[model samples]
Target chain A: MWAFTLRRLLYAVPVLLGVSMLVFALIHLAPGDVVDILVPPEVPKEIADSLRQRFHLDEQLYVQYVAWLGRLMVGDFGVSFFTGRPVAEELFGALGNTLVLALPAAVLGFLLGIALGALAAYNHGTWLDKLFSATAIIGVSLPHYWVGIVLVAIFAVVLNLLPAQGMGFEGLPTSWEHVQHLVLPVVTLSLIPMGVISRLVRANVLEILSQEFVGTLHAKGLFSRRVLYHTLKNAAPSALALMGLQFGYLLGGSILVETVFNWPGSGGLMNLAIFRRDVPVLSATIVVLAAIFVVINILVDVLQALLDPRMRR
Target chain B: MSQVLANLPRATEPVVSVEDLHVRFLLREATVAAINGVSFDLEAGQVLGILGESGSGKSVTLRSLMRLLPPARTRTEGRIRIAGHEITAMDETALRHVRGAKVAMIFQEPMVALDPVFTIGVQIAETIVRHEGISYSAANQRALELLEMVQIPSAARRLKSYPHEMSGGMRQRAMIALALSCRPTVLLADEPTTALDVTVQIQIILLLRQLQQELGMAVIFVTHDVGVAIEVADRIAVMYAGRFVEVGPTEKVIDTPAHPYTAALLTSTVLGSTFGRRLEAIPGTPPDLRALPAGCSFAPRCRHAQDRCRVHMPPEAVLAPGRITRCVRVADGELDLGSPNLSERSIAKP
Candidate 1:
């Protein structure tokens, strides 16, 4: 098992690097740079030259890429063009906040999705099944940003129950306060994925329930609950695969969610950097998110293969 | 009934007696009556072989005994008595207790009969725990004993192995062991060896026969193979179109098949065929259950099907000692079986 996990982890490195390199190229190839965006229109040519030289903007594209790659190897993502701080420092702080929001939402989505999906599958073709399935379809079809905006509009504008947007203030205790601030954003972000995962789980559970093993389990005279739980447990590898993929997707997709909520997460940071054309911060954030996604997918695949031996070969 | 029970053999009465059993499956806009008025008595420790083609209702009848038929869609109408207790009317919980503890089923496909995620040991252990209320360790120990009983090598080591790690034969053996772990009085092997390769198929059948003898459990061996039916089963019930066409002692049924369908089945088997002509196949598939003929379900496929056979379903006829056949013409001697002259004219007419 350790060997399997270590092998999977090792395989993730090139996947991360490949994705990083692609994003890096695309970011660099896009027109405009941090220097172009940050410099004043009135600034003289010599001053612009010094600033360009300072940030290595004067170097060739390949040279700059190699220098950035070298710095990345030593655990440095270089300084943010706007913040003038190590990109890693900003990234870590933002990552913590993003996780704070994403983790709960993910947990909530998974819990609700699995339960709902299981219920729907168990009572398949009934009214309850139809209700849950329809709700999931609508949830999945609606866009995250649109859902976030609608949630904000109804709760903050019409009901006036909570703050419209943004994280908690500096003085207020965060746990409950932040959670209150998080509800709308988290719900909006989780809806589509929750719908998707639950539907997938329902399909998988329904399929597994019909398997001959399930019949054998029934014939063994095990309790209905025992049979159901056993079947679901066996069916879990498929569900787990979806959950893993969704986890990776959530890590990256949460950016749009965070932007809508005005949450101070990596997504929001990336959004700001994009607007200011902070290439280093944007590239670093993309690289990190891509790497995290790759790692998560690899972990999920390995875990699935481990849990269900059929995939080993 | 009480006197009969008292006079009967020492095992807990005949484990199950299914009388006039009918099962109908509602699919989409149509209802297919799979089992129609099927009756049988399974004595404890006796291997009862149900032989038929694919849609002959053997599996359905077996499933109905436990009320394991898929939810509200499939309806089971019958008096299924397990230890003189009516199983058809029992609630889900009661039926559940009866299923694994008193009556267990071994399905057709061995590889698919055990859940893939759990280790073979854990799978068997679960049955022990569920039915016996034993501790995990005790259950595991019993599971190992069962594994050994089924001749699974390296029983202890294989406990941790997943379903896919084992070969097809091993998986089937594991399934059998799991079923046996519960110590069920009635073991329903629904075409247990059907999914196995030909060589492994014989091994499984022999193993089942051995286990049945050792355990003294009533085994309902459901199979389409007449050869297998003769080898393992003491009594054989030949079903056609969800009805029991003929049922009697294995030797009697094989030698003097009273029903036309049974005769056709026996003739089709190459086991004792003297002539080495190319093998014959059952002319057509079983009739569509949804659109069945008005009278006998087997009329379409019967060589001796007459006008009366098409108007009325065949009544049970006791042609010989211990032999029961459901055929209209056989009772009246309208159909001759002594030397069925199947010339070109009689063959193509049906």
Candidate 2:
């Protein structure tokens, strides 16, 4: 098992490299530069040239890529073009904020999805099943930004309950205060994944319920709840795989949601970098996000193997 | 063990009794009458083999004993009594206790019958704990004992093995151990050896017979193979199109089949003089349940069907003690009763 995990990790190395190369090339290919954004349109050509030289924007694309790759190997993300701060420091701060938002959202979404899915399966063909199925479809269709706006309008603007945007008050790190700020953004970010995960879980549970072993379990005099538990255990590998994918999607797809809620996560930071053409921060964030996605996929594989003995090989 | 046996009701009472069982599957466009007016009784330590071809309602009859059919989609009218308890009228909670305790079932495919993710030991132990309310460790120990009881090699190690890791025969053995764990008075085996190899089938038949005798439980073994039915069943009930056409002691049923269907089945086997001759396959497919004829369902396939046979259903007739056959021709004395060729019969007997 350890060997399998190690092998997967090894396989991820080239994948990460490929992702980085693609992101770098795509960003470079866009019709603008950091120097153009930094220097005023009224500035003389020499000042623009000096800024380009300082940031090594004058270097050939391959040279720039190789230099960035070398620095990345040694745990350096260079400096941010706009802030002049170490890109690593800026990236980590943004990542931590994203984690604070994404982790709770993921955990809550997964739990909610499983609960609703189990209920949907247990009450199959009933009004409850129809209700949940409708809710899942609606949740999947409603865009996150729209959900965020609607929630802000209802809770923040009309009801005067719970703040709608940002991480928290600048000086208040109290957990409850943080939670107050987190409600809307997390809800908006988690809706699509929650819908997707619940639908996947419902389908899997329904399939497992019809399996021959479920009949055996029933014949064994197991209560319906226990039978459902066994069904869930058998369905876990598939559910876990979906949850992993949903988590990866939540991390990368939170950009628009973060922009709406004014959440200071990496997604928001990436949004700003894209508009400003901050190449260093943009490339660094994409690489880090891709790396996290690869790591999650590996973790999911290991978990699936552990859950299903048939996959251990 | 003595105390457990003492707690049981008198051994003279039949372990299983079914009366006029009728199962109908309600589909969108049609209602399928799967089982029609089947009745039987089984005493302790006896095996009654139900023989039929596919769609003959062999499985439907067995599953109804446990009320395992989907409630909304299936309608069953019958009285099923297992170990003196009226299962047909019992509520779900009461039925739960009856299952795996007074009546247990083992299915045809062992790999699918056992959950793939769980260790065999956990599944067995779970059944024990659910019924007996024992501690986990105690249940685990019982699981090991059950595996050993089924004669599995390396039983201790197999306790931790998943269903997929074991061979088909081993998985079936494990399933048997699970079925017998609660010492149920009645075991419903639905073609338990059908998915196994021929050699493994014989082994399972022997094991089941040995287990039934040792545990003194009544077994209703369902199968499509006449040969397998002969090997394991003391009494045989030959079903056709959802109803039993002939039922009697194994020897009587095979030697002088009263029903034309049973006689036709005997001649179709690849044993005796028929071994080298072209097989006498049954002439037509089973009648569709939705549009069944008002008279006998098998009249279209029976060789001796007369106008009257097609116009009216045959009443079940008593032919001597402990024997019943449903054929109008059997009562008319026009049916051929020649002894089934002994050479073929002997060769067919396992």
Candidate 3:
């Protein structure tokens, strides 16, 4: 198992390097000049030229990439052009904020998905199954940003029940105040993934229910609850994989929900960097998200291997 | 009537009695009558082999005894009594106690019959704990004993081995051990050896017979192979189109098959007396359950099927004290089951 994990980590290096290179290239290719955006029109040409040279923007693309790669290898993410703060420091801060919002949403989504999916499978063709399935379809279909706006309109503007936007009051995170601000954004971000996971789990559970082992368990005279437990245990590996993938997706792609809620997460930070042409912070954030996604996929593979004996080899 | 009931033999009471079992599968496209008026009584320690081709409702009849069919999709009307307990009338909770305690079943595909994730010991021990109300340790001990009973080698270590780790025969032995774990009075084996190799099939059959005698459990073994049925069963019930066409003692049924279908089945056996000649294959497939003819289900394929046979289903005729056959030709004395020695060579040696 340790060997498998080590091999997976080794395999991830090239993927991360490839992702870093892609992000760098894509950011560079975009129709924007970071130096021009940073320097005002009134600034002298020499000062702007000096700023470009200082940031290595005047160098060849490959040279800039190599320089960035060297700094990244040494844990030195260059300073953000807009903020003048170290990119790693700013990225980590944004990442921490993102995790605060994403973690609860991911956990809640996974638990609810499994519960709802199991209920749907147990009920099978009943009215409850239909209801859950219909709700899942709606959840999957509706865009998160649209859902967030609608929720804000209902809960914030109309009812004034909950805070509609941002992480906390005055950006000072407090438990109660943070929760008050979290509800809408978390719900919006979680909905789509919850729907997807529920569907995946439902399908897997239904298939497991029809397995010959389930019939054998029934013939053993186990209570329906125990039979369900066995069924869920057998179905768990695939569902867990889906959950990990969904978590990785939620972490990397909750951009729209964060934007709609103005939650101070990496997604919003990335949005701000893109707008302000903060290339270093943007590239660094992308690399971190990609690394996280790769790590999560590896974790899921290991988890599946552990759960299913057939996959141990 | 009460006096007649009182006069009935006490020692001969059936452990498993199924009466007029009618199983209908209600699909959206069609309603299939899988088991049509099937009835039988299984005595203690007696092995009754149900022989039939695929789709003959052999498995369905066995499952019905356990009430294992899907409630919504299947419509079953019958009296299924296991050791005098009316299983059909019992609700889920009551049925749970009856299953694996009073009655247990082992299936055809041993590879899939046991959960892949759980070890053989855990699976068997779980049944024991549920039915026996024993601790996990006691159940595990009993599981080890059962594996020993099934003649599995390295019984103690095998308890920890997963189902996939065992060979096909070993897995089947484990499955049988699981079935016998609760010491059920009635064991329903649904084509248990069909998925096994020929050599393994014989070993399992012998093992089952040995276990049946030792445990004194009524065994209802379902199989498609007539040779196997003759080897394992004391009495054989030959089924066709969801109904038993012939049922009698193994020797009597094989020697003097009263139904044309039974005669055809015996003749089709490769080990039969006419081995050197071209085998007599049953001409057509079993009829579709949904669109079965109003008459005898086997009339289309029967060589002696008369015009009357086409219009009316045959009522079962009592050929002897313990033998019954479902065929109009039996009444006319027109059917002749070839030779007794046809299956004698293939029957398992005592």
Candidate 4:
């Protein structure tokens, strides 16, 4: 198991490097650098040239890539061109805020998905199956940001039952007021994972049900609940992998939902970086998100290998 | 009924009995008459091999004995009793209690029959725990003993292995171990060795025979292999289109098969002493169960099929004394399938 974990971690190095390279290439490929947006037309050529050289804009693309890569390895994410604030400090705060939202939403969405999927699969071809399946489809298909706006209108504007946006001044939702601030965005962000994971679980459970082993289980005279235990164990590996992927989607932070809720997460930060052309923050955020996705996938792979012995090789 | 139970020979009463058993699969598209009027009684310590091709209802018959058929889609008509439990009348809860406790089964494909994610020991141990209400550790010990009984090498280590880690033969051995864990009186084996190689097939057959005799459990063995049936069964039932066309002592039926279907099956198989002869195949496919003709089910495939064979279904007739065969010609005693030997009848129609 330790070897498996070590091997999965080893496999991530190239992926992280590739994502970093892509982030660097994308910023370079854009129409202008941070200096173009930061410097005014009235600024003298020497002043603009000094600003450009400061940000490594004076070097070749590969040379700049190597420089950025070196700093990235040393946990140096430069600084935002707009505010002159260290990107790592600014990004970590937003990263923590996103984690607070994403983790809860992932728990809510994935647990609901597993329960609903198991219910639908067990009651396959029945009205309950149809009802849950339709619910999941609607959850996925609904314009969730629009749903977020409706929630805010109902809760903040009309009912005045709860706060509609933001995590009550950011770090963690410590009080009830702060927790209420989490509700709308978390609910909104969770819809896609809930829908996707449910469908995947339903299909996977149905497939396991159809295998000849189910009959063997029956012939062994296991109770219905015990039979379900065996079914769930077999269905777990694939479902866990899907959950990791869906959780990856969640952690990426839906920009629209975050905007609608006025949440100070990575999504809103990235939104600011894009409009202002804060190249360092934008590239750093993208690399961090991609690395997180890779790490989540590695964790899922190791977990799946533990669950299913055949997958160890 | 109470007086009848009292009068019957307690030692001779059959461990498993099926009366006028019928099974139909009620699919949305069609109603399939999978088993049509099947009946049999298997006494304690005896082995009855049900031989047939695929879709001939041999498997259905075995599954129905334990009410293992899908309830939502199946319509069964009959009575089944196994080890003093009325299977047909039992509810889900009752059936579950009796399934592995009194009646167990070994499915055809061992690879699929054993749960792939679970260890072999847990699968076997769970059944023992479920039926006997024993401690988990005790059940595990019993599981180890069963594995050893079935001749799994390094029984202790093999118990921790999942189904996929084992070879096909080892998986089947684990399957047999699971079926025997609760010391069931009647074991229904649905082509348990069909997925195994010829070499492994013989080993499994020998092991099953040895266990059956040692445990003194009544067994209903279903198979397509003639040699397997001959080697293991005391009585052989030749099934065609959901009905047993011929059933008799294994030696009697194998030596002188009255039905042409049985005769064809024997001739087609590559058994001992029949190597040099050009073997024959049963002509045509089995009759469709959904829309069977009002005649002998084997008429299309029978070489001796006459005009009358296609006109009406033949009723069961006594072949000698203990044996029974169904054929229009055999009904009239006009077909001399084979000369009879001594007739010391031990079993008669119920």
- For every candidate, the chain B TM-score is 0.91, 0.93, 0.93, 0.92
Question: Which residue pairs in candidate 4 collide?
Answer: none
Candidate 3 residue-wise lDDT, B226-260, digit = tens = 88898888789999888998899887888878888
Q: Which ten residues in a row have the lowest lDDT in candidate 1 chain B?
A: B339-348
Q: Residues A1-313, candidate 1: write the lDDT tens digits.
A: 6777777888887887787678878988888765767988788979888999998989998898888888888888988888788899888778777776677778988888888899999999999999999888987998888889888999999999877788784323267766688788778877876898789888988998888888877888788788778877777788888887777766764667787888888878888888888888899888888878777777777877877777764
Regions more than 4 Å wrong, model 4: B1-10, B339-350
RMSD of 1: 3.9
For model 1, residues B194-279, the per-residue Cα lDDT tens digits are 88899999999889988887787888889989888988888899998889888888877776677888877766767634343344
lDDT of each: 0.81, 0.87, 0.86, 0.87
Tell me the spans in candidate 2 whose CA falls farther than 4 Å from its real position.
A41-46, A170-177, B1-11, B342-350
Ten-residue stretch with the least lDDT total in model 4 chain B: B341-350
Worst 10 residues of 2 chain A by lDDT: A165-174
lDDT of 1: 0.81
Against the hidden reference, what TM-scores do the models get?
0.93, 0.94, 0.93, 0.94
Give model 1's TM-score for chain A to 2 decimal places: 0.92
Reference-based lDDT, residue B15, model 4 = 85
Candidate 4 docking quality: incorrect, acceptable, medium or high: medium
Alpha-carbon interface RMSD for all candidates, in angstroms = 1.3, 0.6, 0.9, 0.8
Which is the better candidate, 1 or 4, if ranked by TM-score?
4
**Model 3 TM-score (2 dp):** 0.93
DockQ of each: 0.80, 0.84, 0.68, 0.77
Native contacts retained by candidate 3:
0.67
